[model samples]
Target: MFLQNNEIRDLLNQVADLLEIRDDNPFRVRAYREAARVIEQMTEPVASLVKANKDLSQYRGIGRDLAAKIREIVETGGLEQLRRLRQELPVSLLDLMQVPSLGPKKTAQLYKHLGVASLEDLERAARRGQIADLSGFGEKSQQHIIESLGRVKKSGEKRLLWSDAAVHARALEEYLMDIEGVRRVRVAGSFRRGEETVGDLDVLVTCGRDREKDVMEAFVSFEGVKNILSHGKTKSSVILRPGLQVDLRIVAQVSYGAALHYFTGSRAHNIAVRKLAQDKGYKINEYGVYQGEKRVAGKTEKEVYASVGLTYIPPELRENMGEIQAAADNRLPALLKRSDIRGDLHCHTRRTDGHGSLEEMAHGAIAMGYQYLAVTEHSQKVAMAGGLNEKQVLQYMKKIDAINEKFSGFRLLKGMEVDILADGRLDLADSVLAQLDLVVCSVHYQQRMDEKKQTERIIRAMDNPYCHILGHPTARLINTRDPMEIDLEKIILAAKDRGVILELNAQPDRLDLPSSYCKMAAESGVRIAVSTDAHSVENLELMENGIAAARRGWLTRNDVVNTRSLSELLRLLRRP
Candidate 1:
């Protein structure tokens, strides 16, 4: 009955979205949104805090009332205020906001003007030319919406970020393991593969064959189960409350590894492995590796791979992208591990849009066992974030200097996430940028520029000696907006030439530098900083997501710049 962190965040976000749709107090709505953000970044479960009778109000953005509401959710498994809000207004209206580039304002417009309560309704209106006539949405905007709708519809199946899906999958695995009859439970499928997004989860459980029904019953009765899709003696499927599908299978321990390998597949990888098995006069399947009906090897994934004369491939590398050949050749990379990261290069504090104070962020970094952290707040170009101007930047640097004095071992490096202006110049002047320890230049606007121009713009920014890293290189938001057409090859090469680092931003929604591109950068010998770009103390925990991405991209400890000692990293950041 424990609520996963993601569930709490989703519920809180629902409240925020409902409040926004209802046009409630802006501050109140912001509080909820901020609270959701904080909860999502938390490494520890809020439910655990609730169970311990901890003071939740101490967390940023959670006041006394929000604390009580959170407590009620943990105890009752639902929020009464959210229930009342949904009763006042149908929740479907918020789905339209999922369309790329459509904000709450536009969503409300569609709802108010065209009675568009769902994606279907909105599409019908747009195709009928009704949306074009709305006050704010003209023909051009309508065309854009229509195009975006196609993107939304084409996306199909509504996948959640791997990290988000992990929250549910891991929770369910643990919950199932607690069942008396359950001998073992492992979350398979894309979650195990470390795919950036997961559409569904396949959970394999090994329990007494005679107790299958008992396990099936418990699976369907999970607290997060929103709907039972099926119930059976050996297998059952349920859709979790957050719309993630989970399929539970009762497996025999003897075939557990084979089942895990079969279920945790990139279909092509499994097919290739099966082909290899066939060449060896054997069959590989979920049941077990068979040689003319007699089981051969399948007790472990390593056995399965070895039976085919191949070494075991890490789950992250099983994308059928030459991994089989690499495994056979014993050339697979020793992937990056979480422990290799020494510090985060991109960070923010109260000086910008971040929720944490400077000292708070530093302490959090220290708690993470980091040797250093870059306090890279936004520059003046990002006005909405309370971006710092030149004078403030000077004061901010001075503040960082003073803060650094208090810490004996850990260091707070002064820096800015300087906006890469549309024409390629940095938001901060060279003089101001020169005074900082590092600069992470990023594009906050003009994301629609043609591929060539975007590539040129980013390369030009790298030409600036102070620009040490390119933050979120593609400026992509997963499932929301497409990556800008920057030629990553060109950017990677430019970064190498300019001694600039590329960032693998660990934000769940923006795991920028997708694994494919991360591989490209690695092959080109460009170093990466797997920074979380943390905005809160909790956000620092997101570094794991970046590590996961790095592993999937075939990066090693040497491929990441942050794995170096503080002195080495400082030397690397110092561009020639």
Candidate 2:
């Protein structure tokens, strides 16, 4: 019955969604939403606080009422208010909100106007040309809905982002590790490979044969399990309530490594490895490596790889993408680690839409051992985020200087996340931009431009002498928004020529300059910056996601700009 942070956060988010659909007080809805964000970003589990009878109101956005509700949820595993809201509203209504471009207000409109209560209902209305007649939804919006529905249907089972999958994976791992006789547990497959999205979780455990029943029983009876698909002595499958399928298999210690390798495969990688094993007169399978019916290697992944005549390949690089050859040649680049990062180049504060103030953000960065942190507030073009104008930015510069004067060792880089307008002009004046430590330019609007124009627009923005980095190059929000159409190869080449760093935005949703592009940039000799475009101090932790993406791209520490010391980084940022 233990509730993890994600579970508690999800419950709060559900409450917020229901409140929004009910058209309840905006403040109340926002309170729930804010509380959800706070809990989601918190490093500690709220359940522990409840267990200690500590007041949750000490945290931001959690008031007395919300704190009491959190305590209630932690104690009882349910909220009466959320239960009542569920009763009042059809659960399918919440599903509609998942459709791209369908907010609660628009969903309410569709419901009232066309009786659209589900994705199916909305799809029918869009196809029948009924949604366009609604107040806010136009013909284009209707078409978008239809197209989005098609994507949803095509995507099959919903996939969770790595960040989300990690939560469930860790929770299940913890649960299984606590069971008796469990010797070893590992979450394999794409989750272990560090893929951005995961469709299902594959858990492998090594334990005594007698403990198989106990393990299977415990797994199927997990607190978050919504349905048990199958149960057997050695294998079991269950669907967690969050719509993620988890398959657990109990294996013998002797075959644990082989099973791990087999389950952690990108099919292509496994096939190549098997072919290599066959060439050496050895057979590789889930059970073990066999040479003339004798088990030669299996107890360790390194043993399996050695039997195949290659060094052990890290899971992240086991994609059969030249990794075998690289391993054979002993030319694999050292992958970047979380410890390699020295600073974050792009972050926000209360100066813009960020939740925390400059001081709070700076101290948070200091805690992370960052020698420098950039204050990259949005430019004036992004009005929705309360972006700053030239005059305002100048005033903010003075404040940054004052803050910098307070510390001798730590440096707060003066920077702005300037917008690259439709015509590719920088949002802030060059005079204003030149005065800062660095500039992070991005496209905030007009993302639907054609490939040529979009590529040219970005390239032109990079042409600016003051532009240091391109923020969220694709401007994608995973599962919600598609990346802008652009000639990425041309942009990468342009970035290489212009000395502009491509940002691997660490905002879980927008891990832009994605692995593929990051690889391209690195191969072309363009150093990338893995930055957390964090709005809150808590969000600074997202740097881990950026580093994961970088590793997936096969980037070395030398390929990242922020991995350098402050002086080295400053030299790199300086224009020729």
Across 1-576, the per-residue lDDT of candidate 1 in tens digits comes to: 678888888899888888887788999998888888878878788999999999999987789988998899899888999999889877887778777767676787788778898999988999999998999778877887888888778878679988999888878888899888788899988899888899999999999877788889889999889899999888899999878999999888899889989999989999999999888899999989999989988888898999998898999988899899999998888899988888998988877888889999999999999999999999999998899999999998888899899999999988889999998999988989989988999998878777899899889889999999999998888877778877788788888888888999999888888889899998998888899999999889988889988989999999999999989988888897
* Cα error, candidate 2, residue 573 (Å): 1.0
| Pairs of residues at least 3 apart in sequence or in different chains that clash in candidate 2 | none
lDDT of 1 at 443: 94
Q: Write the per-residue lDDT of candidate 2 for residues 1-576, one digit (tens) a residue.
A: 678787898899899888887789999998998888888888777888899988899986789999999998899999999999989988889888667767788877887778889888988888999988887777877887888888888987778889989888998999999999999999999999999999999999988878889999999999889999999999999998778999999888888889999999989999999999989999999999999899998999999988988888989899999999999888888999989999999998877878789999999999999999999999999897799999999999999999999987899999999999998999999999999999999998988777899999999999999999999999888886778889899999988888889999987778898998888899999989999999789899999888888988999999999999999999999866
Give the C-alpha miss distance for residue 236 in model 2, angstroms: 2.6
Our model 2 lands, by Cα RMSD against the true structure, at 2.4
* Model 1: pairs clashing at backbone N, Cα or C within 3 Å: none
lDDT of each: 0.88, 0.90
